[model samples]
Structures are given as C-alpha cells and as structure tokens.
Target: MFDLSKEFESFYKNKVVLPNDKQNDLREKKNLNISRLKDGLNEYNEENKTDYKIINTIVQGSMAMHTVVQNDSNDYDIDVAIIFEKENLNDKGPLAVRNIVTNALKRKCENFKKEPEVKTNCVRIEYQDGYHVDFAIYRRYKKENESEYTYEHAGSEWTLRDPKAINNWFKDEIKDKGQCLRKVIRFSKMFCKSRDYWVNMPGGLIQTVLCDEKIQNSYERIDEIFYHTMVEVKNRLDNDINVYNPTDTSLSLLSTKDHEKKVENFKNKLNDKLKKLDVLFESDCDKSKAKNAWYEFFNHDYWKEDTSNEKVQKYSSCYRNTEEFIEDLVNINEQYYVTVSCNVEANGFRLQPIKKLLRSLPKGWLPHGFSIKFNVEDTNVPKPYNIWWKVRNVGEIAQKRDMIRGQIEKHVGNCKQEHSDFFGNHYVECYIIKDNVCVAIDHIDVPIE
Candidate 1:
C-alpha cells in the first residue's frame, strides 16, 4: 500500500546506481535488440510480399513493462505479433503471404546462425537473440457491401488485416506510447514477489510525484511512471546482492573472466528478450512449496517430468496381510534405505512395491494452481508397469514435523470414486518426513500464479 515516490525513496535508499557508462551501454543494447528485430521484419517484407503489410512490431515483457533487474539479468527474448488486416488473410492473400514471409526468415539471424530451429504456421515462431515472434494476422471483417473494420483471432490458419488497421486495434489499449505505472509493480514484485504490490504502489507514487508539481502532470504517460519505477528498482538491486555476502563472488577457477563475460552476454540476451515480454513469467514461481521438497536428483532442475511417455495401469490391491503392509510402510517411512518391500493384489495377481501413475495435466494445473503448466515427466518406476499395494492416508499434517517437503504428483489407482474419497482429486505426492518418518511431499516453491 506504500505510495510510489515514498516506495521509490525507500527502494532507492537501498539501490546503488550504475555508472553512466554501464547504464548507457545497457540502454544502447536494449535499443539495438529492438532495431535488430525491426530490421529482420523489414528484410522479411522486402524479400517476400504479403496481403497485409507488417506495420510495426510491439515488444511485450519485462523490459517492455519495466521491471526491476539485477546485475545478473537474463535476456527475456522478444515477442512480436505480425500485424496485418482481416480481409487480406484468406484462401489467397495473407495466408499465402505468410508462407513466403516465413521462408524469408530462413536466411540468417546472427553470425550465420538460422535460429528458431523449428517453425510452425499458426503457433508462435520463436528464434534466438531471445525473440519470440508471433504472426498475429489481424483483419477488419466486413462484407464487400460495406467496408468497415471488426476484429477477431486468426484460428490456427493464415489470417489477415491491414497494417495500419491492425496496429490501430492494439494501440488503443495496450499502446506503447506511455503508462509508467508498470515499473512500480515490477520493482515491488521483486522486493516482495507479490502482484498485490503493483496495485498499491501506483497510488502512492502518483501522490508523491504530484507533490513535485512540475513533473506531476507527466504522470499520465505510463512509461514515465514505468521509467521512474525502474530507476528506483535498479538502485535497490545495486545495493542489495552486489554489496553483501562477500563470499558470493562471481570469480571461480574456471576463468572467472570468461564467466563474467558470459554473464553479461546472458544478461544482455535476457534484457533484450525481456523487452518483448515472452520471458515474463508469473511474477515469480511459487517455489515456497519446494522448501520441504525432496532432493531426488543432484539438481532437480536438471531432470524433467516425462509423464507423457508413461502409461500407468491402475488396479486395487489389498495387502494379503495388513500387518506386512504396515511393516513395509514403516520401514520405508522410517529409514532412508535404498529400497523397501511390500505385498499386494493387482489385476487378479499379487505384486509388491506398486508403480504409480504420473500424469501430464493441462498447463498451470500443477499443484501450482491454474496458470502454470510444467513439463515434469514420470520416472523411477521399476519395470513391468503395474505395482500392487494397499495403504491408508498418513492423515493431515499436524505440525512442522508432520509435513515433509518435496515435489509429488497425484497418483490415482484403479479404485473407483466411491472406493476412496481421494478419488476425484489426486492428492499431492509429498516428500516430507513427519516424526522422523518419511512422508508424502509437496513442493513449496511452485508459485500459485
């Protein structure tokens, strides 16, 4: 709820301004990336003709939105939509032109590298230098009887609209001309990693900026508000990570110099892409769920969830002996042994240590909620797909000791909905230890966004 200038003032107090040279270089790079993409589009046009002209490329993302960046910034890549007219994309015009335009890009991107190794028609066509170009074939729909413009989404095929007409459509609301409020939101999110910060900071900053009288009126331009927010955020980043943690040096035996160079290169790439907004992830990933997440691999980020490749068989197996199941569960839950033993019935047969199903749910559906879809795959299941076993819920987490933390996927067995209350919704596969006993795990870091 803090006001903008006040927020900026507090944020600024913690920031260390970059030397003019560095700032200028960074700024210049930002402009250069923009130019590169623009030039590429122009080249695309000259080489090939389309029904609709690509009027302008508007970049969306972090850099464009003006977020707080640290010394170690990454290229967010550029996201550009090919703006055209509605009438042009049809059996003959823009749709056909799209093919030619896409071909034009096959030439070269950087130093002889043809980025965007893969290209598809309707979806986004992404490339290097951190650029994600989307052909948003727009059109002003109408009949030959009357020529008026109406808008629509070009379903997975080649579609069209006018260059001026198309650009005008988006310009009205999502215009780049101005709107500075976003910068404040960016700064506050990095500080608090909360979207709520954005809503609150603007009112406060507007109040403070108005107090200056001279600059008060400029508030109408969103970019002005944005630039101001960036100025403050940049300052904070400088004072924070760079100043403290003496041991947190970028130097290493592997040529600290080389690493530093790559860091800058990466930062540049990130910044350049960021300008387009493709790199704009949900303000922050909710890894909070990961605090208690289990460490199955040296670096969990290294391995991915390959669930699509898996075909899990669901079957119910009541342990032939209840005590034996409990005993095995106790052993696995209590000890960190490499493996454990169990017995159960599945598919009219008996098997031990059942293999669970790993699902590939729709994106943003990860226990991360409705907006984030992860590509985690299933692994660690022994051969012969089905493992039969019977068990009970360890019960709700009662205290810190009860909740074990690790990423888990909901595993559903053959049990019908009426068979188990856990049927319809898959419970989080947890990796926590309660009372020194191994437990079901849930990652804490996956952001709710």
Candidate 2:
C-alpha cells in the first residue's frame, strides 16, 4: 500500500501552519490594538465621568489557539474580549456598555483609516491594509458568591459566555492528543480553506470538535487522521446531530436554520476529498500519480515540485516596456504579423504561412523572413535594459536548419529571422533581462506550412 504520511506531514508544516514571522506580526498588531483599546476606554471614562473601568483584555479565538492560516487577502479576523469591572454594568444595559466601548474606540482611534463599526455584540475596527479587530465587551462581576462575567449579546441581552473557557478546553484537548491533534485541526482547516463550498461551512470551533471526537488515537498517519476525522464529521452531519460548544453545552455550534444545507455541502466536499485520498493511498510506487492526487486534494502549488535543494533567487528589479514604444517607433513604423496553417500527412506534419499559400507556392515551402514583435508597458525605471530572443526548432523532422537564439539591441523589439531554410516546427521566445535576471518573457510557436 502507498503511504503519504511523510508528504502530509510536510504539507502541514509548510502550508497549513502560519510561519513564525507572520505569527509574530499578527501578535504585534493584536497587542498594539489591545493597548489602544485600554487607553481609549480609560480616556472615555475620565472624559464622561463614567465609572467604566477596563479590568483586562484577553485575546480569544484562533489567534490565541494558534490555528490561524495565513490568508493571502489579509483578512485575518481577530477576536478580543474587552473585560470591564462589574460596577460598569450596575447602571448600564448591554447596549449601553457596548456603545461605551465602541464610542471610546472611535474617539481614541483617530489614526485609523476608517471609523470603528458598532456591531450587535462587538465593535469592529477595520484597517485599510486588510485585517480587522473585533472588540467584544464583557462585564466582570468580581463579587464573592457571584463572581462571573457576562458578555453583550443580541444588542440588548447580556449572556454568560467565557472566551477563555473555550480556549482552555481546546488547549487541554490538544495536550491529550499530543501535538498531532493541533496539526490535524490545522490541516482540516487548510482543507476547508482550499475549497469554496467548505470555506464558511466548518468554522474553527466546529472543526476542533470534529477532530476531538473522531481522531481518537486510531491512526498515526496524517492522511488517515484526516480521512477518519472527515468521515466522522460527515456521519454526524448526516445524522442531524448538533455540535455543542465545549464551554457551554447548551449553545449548539451548528444552530442556524440553514445549517442543513451547509452540512450537506460539507458532506459532499468531504466525500470528494476522501475519494482523492483513497487514490493517493492506492498509488504505490507511482510518484507522479500520488503528487497529482495530492495536488487535486490541496488545490495548491506547494506540492507541484521538489524544492528541497533549490536556492532562493531574488531579482533586483523588473519593469515592462510600453506596447506603443515597441510597436510604433521601435519597429520603424512597419506593421508586423505572423500567420500559421497546418497540414497533416501520413509520414509528417507541415505548417505554412497564409501569405505563402496565397502566393500558390509549392508544397513543403517556407517564408523567407519571419518577423516577430515584442513589447511591454511603460515603467519609471531608467533605460539600458537588454532584450534577448531565443528561437528553437521543435519539429519532428530531423536534420533541419539550426535555430537562432541571441540578445538583441536595448531598443529593438522586432525579430525578422530567416525561416525558409527550416522545414519543421519552430518556437520564438523573447525576454527582457536586467542585472542578469529576466524581468519579462513572451513566447509563440511557429507553425510550418
């Protein structure tokens, strides 16, 4: 049997988990926001003569648990619980408390590009660059015999919810399953992120629940863990079971009315991935097949090549040459075009330009000179860039004339080469090189007549 355990492990490490640098960047941003929130609240209380004291602020959700995936779009959603002293709730309702926090942030966050939006349960501050920070107001009652915290919910009601409790529960569960559990959850999340149907279907908490229940030390391989976990999740959804929050059992994670449709979609996506996993597992000794299966499953380019020995190459700079510059003045005001026509015979294939055929030339004939043009957009970079043209004979017929591939003038973008001597297929490639690195490339295949 084919084993993809090592591949899966590598994928998880490289693709699923966010890099340390990115994680640190997120942490720094979150801390900065937290500090601003505290300062904002303190200033608001002093300005309005309100006794609303910000006791503490706690980071919750995937940010705290370290299960967040690196989003290319920079839409990382952060959840922060803004805990206030119990005295703040003695005279104010949930909405009032929420508004106080929201107003404070709006007044204090003058440096932000956009104003903070007051949502039902949290104040959302969106940054121009992309990520957003959500501040959920919570009133902490530290009195003896009734020490607890109540969070704003539904704009008016105060609900008993503990963000730290859920985070702690997830941490304990991860400890029990060893480090693999976190990897499994992150991999599952990565799978969800790879597809559109599963994007918003399975949330972080729901995925955590599924992994905790299904991946009970049954298998050691990452692929097996993924398969079993997804299978169990599908079974649960098929049976119309509700996954409750570990912190609050009464609150069902899948409580929306449209959850049935969402669950059905999740099941369909899971089934498709499971089929691909089976294919990879059965593709023993077939490295290409296994890689293709993984590519299909992950829908990412990280698995496309082996890069263990490859060194990183950095280009100093790159720019495009404007089309008008190359088309009008560069070509000496002469219009250039290429035409291709193909004819298939029993023994060989022949390609010809329409101009040659229109002239009623003999069979297996070729054009005397083939002109190819290259151009690019305008750039602010100073001049003196090199342009190179590469032509190769790619036809089936052997003993054809040699192809030409060489550098042209900096301002020259047109290539009028002799093609009448060759009889087979040909390809022309153009590149703009700077500092020994190619900044732009274009290619076209030459067809024989």
Candidate 3:
C-alpha cells in the first residue's frame, strides 16, 4: 500500500542539486561548432552579395547568464538567437539568410550521422542536455528625418531610436554585458533550484522579463501594483482548499513559517491597538463572537479611518475573511508564475478544512437551532474570476458543503447557475495561458459567503 507517485516525486527533487560542468561546456563546444558553421554562412553571404547584415547577437536564458552550466552527467541544453536584416516584405530574404546558416550547420553535423539539433530558423540551435541557441534577424531599417526606424522582424512592433541617444537608462545597473547576464542568472535561480520548473512549465518568458534591468530599474507606478497583487493571491487561495498534507510526520507540514511570520507581524502591529481597546480579554467562545467583535471594531469611525484609508488596506481588505476560521493549502510558485497570472492566475488549490471553516467562521457565535440559507455566485467559474468567502463554522465537512450550497442557491436564484451537489473530483483552474506560451497557474477554492 505504497503511494508510488509521491515517492517518485520526492526522489526526483532530492537528486537535483546544481547543474555540473557539463551544463556549461556544451556552450563552449557550441561556440566552436557555430564558428565552423558561420564560416560557411559568410561564404554563402559573399556569394549572394544581397546586402544582409547581422544586427545583434544575444545569448538568452540560463546559459547566457552563466548561472547554469553544461553538465555531462545531467541533461543540459543551450539556446542562441542570431538576428539579421533584409528588405522585401513578400520575398524570403532573411529566411534565405537563415537557411544558409542552418543548412551549413546541418551539413557539418550530418557527418556525425544525425540531423542538426535545431528548429526551422537558422538562428535557433539546440544543444545536448536541454539547451538551445536562438538566432534573431533584424529586418532592414530606414532613416527617417534623422531618426532610424527599425521594425522588429515580425513588423508588428517597431523600434525608433534617436542617433544621439544610447539610452543607458539602466547604465548604472547593467554597466557591462556580463553583468546583465549575471543579474538575469541570479533572478532565474530565484524561481527554481535551477530550471526544472521551466522544463515542467516551459517557456521561460517570465524569467526574461524579471531580469530586464529596465523594468527592475523603473520606480514609477511600482508600489501601486505590488499591494494589489498580494491581496489577490490571498483571496484566490482562500477557496478550493482541497490540497492534502497527508498528516504524516515524515513529510514537512505546509510552509507555516512564512504564514507564521505574517500573522506575527500583524499581531505586533495591532498589539498597541488591542491594549487600548476595551475588550482585550475577550474569550474565544465561538466564531460568531469573534465576528461580532471584528465587525464592531471596524465599523467604528476612528478605527475604520486608520485602516480603511491606508495602502495596505487594498491587500488587507479581505484578510480577516480569508483566515477567520479556515486552514488553506497554498501553492507558492516561482516569482514569474505569480507575476503573469497574478491576482487570479496563480496555481494550486486550497482545501477548506471545510469543517474548520464552518466552526471557526462563526467565531464561537453558533446559534444551536438556527437554519442557514445558501446561494451561488456566478463569478466562481475561474479566472478573470474573484470570490468572496467566509467560513462560518458549520458542524462537519459534509454538513458545511450542504449549508454552503443552500446559501449559494438562495443567492443565485435567477443567475441560471444551478444550486449543485458537491462532486468528489475537481481541478481548480487558477491560472491559464492566453495567446502567450507562458502559463497562468491558478488555484481552486470552496468558500462560504
């Protein structure tokens, strides 16, 4: 009666530490290979003489930043972006340029009796052990009124630079090329032990954006965004708390340390306020009593103004409702993950500890013979979705579910969304991918309002 699934996952993480030397070495070898391949491209370019030029050569991802190296023992891969330029919109000018390079590299590697480790474009090359090289092509630009107007290869986005302006906006931060890559590497490691999550999630666009000094350096409109994000994650995780902790001693408990710190900080900040308040010694009799106290405190003009007007209010707006009587299962993802899907898109689900929410939400204020009404909200379908929940402690998980469904049904009598029975199996779609390859990981919740 062993759960093989959990066992394998535990084994995989323990085995992964850091990428060995083989991780970076293939990058070195790839340089030699690219050099050899480039020689042939130059010959082809000279023969064609079509006036195409290599505009920029950028090395992106872990290898480029050097945080991760090539390890022969582990699976390592490298990526390269080779950018160039051409004129005709209809004709395949750059594609030809790309073809010559890719074809030449393919031919050279063919002697090894294998197709080149690559994709369609010549600028992009994949190396052994999960690394790749991307070649970027810059379309030819035109000089307009003393300004150089260069559109991206795709032509949808264009860059117009003033000749005199080198825009060292990040000059203080990204002084040199290596520093830029190093910063990126440091940020990339923040998300994963190395890049395993990137493989599981794939499309490391979030890492790239976080590494960009320009964005990091920007101070305007920053605080405004961060506060809202915290509350959003908290609110969403409050629901769908179905994640299990196995109640086993061997495995660690949910990361209560972080949660402890947060709660402690709040308690400390509120200590003085609690002291001056009249009901400091109020006993925990029922959730209903606590709810009454909290409501009374907030409803008072002085207390409301002190809290309701502050920036933290945005995040704290729903704090009481979320933690009132509920224990939740939270999925902490890499910074990039939360960055994109953010508010509604962060992944993982919370298991309501349904019974706990019911009993606790009442805050010790349960009326023994009271009947509860239930209703549903139409916005619960998922992202672009938000939920307002309060787990007023009911007796049992089954009882709580029934109570909540009844309440929601009363709330949504005309919404056409049915008052439904609880299904044992469900997947919470916290985050989703829209247009971009990057994902929006989300969570599920079963909240009582």
Q: Judged by TM-score, which candidate is best?
A: 2
Per-residue lDDT tens digits for candidate 2, residues 1-449, read 35677677657655766754465466567667777777887788788776667766667777666677753347677888877766655757777777777777776677676898888778899887788898887766644676554443324477767646776686567656765667677777777778654554657777777778777466877777776777777777677657787877788887685764555666778877767766655535476677777778778786686543333111101211111111111211001112222222222323434344435656544443443333343332234555555445443232222222222335344343434345555544454555443334344445555
lDDT of 1 by residue, 225-330 (tens): 5444443433443343122111223423123445334333323332332333222223442332221121110112212323234331111111111111111122
The TM-score between candidate 3 and the true structure equals 0.33
Candidate 2 clash figure, as a count: 8
CA deviation > 4 Å runs, candidate 2: 111-113, 142-155, 196-199, 258-260, 283-285, 306-449
Quote the RMSD, in angstroms, for model 1.
Answer: 24.7
Q: lDDT per model, in order?
A: 0.31, 0.60, 0.33
Residue 383 of model 1: what lDDT?
Answer: 32
Task: Report lDDT (Cα) of residue 143, candidate 3.
Answer: 55
lDDT of 1 at 412: 33
At residue 416, give the lDDT of candidate 3: 25
Better of 1 and 2 by lDDT: 2
lDDT of 3 at 405: 24
Can you give the TM-score per candidate against the true fold?
0.29, 0.64, 0.33
Cα lDDT of model 3 by residue, 1-449, tens digit: 11122222221222322322243244455555656566656665577674444454444444433334221124444444444444533345545545666665664553342455334433555544444555444455565665655544422233332211111222222333323233332323332332232233112222232234223222222221221222232233344211222222243322455533433332332332333323423453333333333334223222223333566555434322211101012111111222111111112323323334346555432222222222232222234422222222222343334332212111122112111133222112222222221122222222323
lDDT of 1 at 326: 17
TM-score of model 1 relative to the true fold?
0.29
Q: After superposition, which runs of candidate 1 have C-alpha atoms over 4 Å from their true positions? A: 1-52, 61-72, 90-99, 112-114, 117-135, 140-148, 154-184, 191-449
For every model shown, the clashing-pair count is 77, 8, 76
